[model samples]
Target: MMIRSALAGLALALTFLMTAAPVSAQTVRVGIVIPQSGQFKLLGDHVRQAFEVWNAGNPGVFSDVVEGDDGCTEQSGKDAAAAMAEAGVDIVVGFLCTETLAAALPLLTAEGIPVMTLTVRADIIAEEAARLGWKFFRLAPRAGSEADIAADAIFRLWADQPFALIEDGAISGRELVEAIRIQLENRGLKPTFVDNYRPGQATQPSLMRRLKSAGVSRVFVGGERADLAVIAYEADYQSVPLKFMGGDALNAPEGENPIPEGTIAVLAAAATSGPEDQAARDAFAGHGLIAEGLRIPAYAAAEIIGAAATRMTYGETSLQDLLGQTTFSTALGPVTFEPDGERREPGFVLAILEDGSFRRLSIEDTAALAGDSN
Candidate 1:
């Protein structure tokens, strides 16, 4: 009878141990929703590569990647958000364009899942945060900032030169042009011309003629990859002798090499493999991923999520609590969020085409460019 009682007690203890042992901390699944197939495909590829590298470093952290075909469209974004919510993703990252992000914002915020957005449009993220609180965090700079940077770079490079502004109707493009216009006006300078063009138009011959007729020596353009390529190619074809300046979209990995000569682009500095970005790079490389610009934000997003998860007492932590009061060192720089969820970092860089490759231009600062052309 005694032996039987001891056996029963041992069995009970074993059962309790089995039940309480933490189950290897089930995979922290992250869902990436972006345009896997569409006009923004190259940007999507960059984001995907960054996530892949980060995931490779930390094996088994991601259970799976749920592809959201948000082709920068409202319908696609809504569908993708619903699918991700239905699939029960712990976190969702990547909405590169503003339109898609706007579409999915309501759904994702309502579900209470934290989203790390790579879209650069400030207004969309700001408006969404105003409506939804800390559920959305942006990793990219605002359109106004990019435009200001571009204006400063151009003014410094070619002081007292008549310039023109062109855009391709992207939200980033329109806002950037406006910002550049504001900067030019602040310096008592005015653009020779300002106009918007439809995307993928065969040639901007008429616009090119107007720019040349206005005797514009410098031009600032705000557009995505294809638009930049088209404008550059058209300018070359039209023999427009103006120097071209652009925003971050022109720095895209896919379209970098094709930019015509005499074109300078302002872009986010690529995160280099140095002491600062090394550990995170290693973490991402361990997963067979190459951490690049914009992608670094994705890895940082994962790190943020992981750190927050570690601090939670089992299921007690909420996404809001985790994101509301957390900071992490990212490849871009130290990332801390305001109540509005915008990253507080001075993160843009100006790159000029030197011998067919884009290289960073050394500018003192945006504000210091008044009356000086570097």
Candidate 2:
């Protein structure tokens, strides 16, 4: 009778252990809701690579990646959010395009999942936060902020030279160009010319002629990669002496044709082979991924999730408390959020295309530039 009783107790203990094993291994799962296959696929791929690198260094922190095709559309974003919620992911870390993010915001907020967005449009983030609550945060600089950084660099470089402003009619592009113009105007320098162009139309010979006629020594262009590249190529082909300046979209990696030489691209501060950055890069390389824009932000998002999970008393985490208290020291820089979930401090670097590769240019006190609306 005693032996039989002991056997029964051992069986009960084994059953409990078996049940708890899976729960223990389920550390923290984050859903990366970005377009895996679409126009924004490149951006999505970079975000994934960055997350993988973070996961590799800190194993068991991020359990899985749930892909969602948010394709910069409202309907698609809704579908993506539904899929992520169904997967029971703890957090979500991406939305490269603004429209998609706007659509996904309410759905993710309702699910009580923290979303760290990489989209640069300020209005989308502000509107979503105002409509929702503190469920969303942005990692990238705002469109106006980025444009102002580029403008500051240009103004400093060619204070005496006449400049022209060219804008593509996208929401972000238009805002950036206007901001740049405002900054120039504040410095008592008006743009020699301002023109709007539709994205992805054949090279406008008349527009190019006007730019050349303006005789501006330097020009600031706000447009997508293809549009900007076309303008640069046309300017080069025409042998215009004008140097061009634009945003990071121009720095995007390409095959064969690239942004013409004698052009400067202002971009987010990039890592240059430090121990932390190299380790992160190596981890991604192991997975056949290359880190690019918003890549560091993705990795930082994972780290933030892990830290929040660790802080939970009973190992039962809530997105609100986790994000509210977390401060991530990422490869990019120290990341802490404001009440509205925007970065407390934003920074950018001016990079020049040197020998077919983007190289960072040193700028002092980027915070001052951030504050300088002029």
Candidate 3:
């Protein structure tokens, strides 16, 4: 009888251990894909640091991190993806180059792993994702989103007023201006003047003269800071009263020709501004690094990945479903992914140049300015 009781007790204990093992021993592996070597290594380092800082703050969130270097090349990306799949990571994040990411998607998808890219903003990625059925998510806005945001802001503020669309003839500027023009036209609007001006000139007096003759009171300049400065300078020189707006390039570092006061800019808001981003910013600052560039976005990616992993581990939900169905609270702000894995709303804001820096424009303030313009 004593032997029988002992055997029964041992069997009960073993059963309990077997039943609870999965719950207690579950581990989530996260794969990090970035250019670990090459010219882009500095960017990869920043991303890795971001993940480290996040992990330190939230211990035990990720059981293990598998690192793979994309090398910012097609072959390297394929190798990296294969390694991540072989390691059986739950999800892979932190791609920088479009070339690398585009090359790696097929392999990662075949392994049934989701990807959240920190910096690859090429629109083709999203389009390809839709067509190819890739499980992809993007944290950065698409490249053309700059023009879309700029055009929307202009249409809101200066649509009623006489406005002109001008470019510097560079591919970046030309594409931006052309896209803006198309967006505005689709909205049943047209520019009062349209032209391309030669960039890098000492003065834009001729451009200013033509703008004045066309009665363009507002102009969207798709060009560099120096060219815009010269345009503003010549506008003042030739007594052409014009209010200028430009894409994010307007927020570039001040050169010899400083960005004029009152110039409107559609720029990405600086990280760590509000309370939502404060903790991550503090984390970066603790490591003696500023939360900027790819750093903050990578931090935001960490937040999303951690949350998704936690949910998928406990609940009866897959990582891809969690990513697509949920709205993640990130350092950058609330991030919601669309069904197609693109960011639902791009985080671009209208700002004004004041005191050599860009200050975010409030909605009320922007509306009031538009009213004044009209």
lDDT of 1 by residue, 244-269 (tens): 78877776655432666546777775
lDDT of 2 at 225: 62
Ten-residue stretch with the least lDDT total in model 1: 365-374
Off by more than 4 A, model 3: 1-27, 37-39, 269-272
The lDDT for every candidate, in the order shown, is 0.70, 0.70, 0.84
Q: What's the distance in Å from true for residue 313, model 2?
A: 3.4
1 against 2, candidate with superior lDDT: 2
Residue-pair clashes per prediction, in order, are 8, 0, 0
Give model 3's TM-score versus the native structure. Answer: 0.88
- Better candidate by lDDT, 2 or 3: 3
Residues 1-374 of candidate 2: C-alpha lDDT, one tens digit per residue = 02234588797777777766644323677888777786778778777777777777778656687777767787887888888889998777787777777778789889887677876556557655966683788776655568778777767776667778888888767888888888878888788889888778657567689989988867788876677677777777888866778886675665444666646776765432333455556666777766556676677677677676666544454556667667766665667777677776554667666677766653543333323323
Q: Compose the digit string of candidate 3's lDDT tens values, residues 96-213.
A: 8887899888889999988888877778899999999998998887778888899898888888899999999998899999999999999999999999999999988788889999
The local distance difference test score of model 2 is: 0.70
lDDT of 3 at 205: 78
TM-score of every model versus the real structure = 0.69, 0.75, 0.88
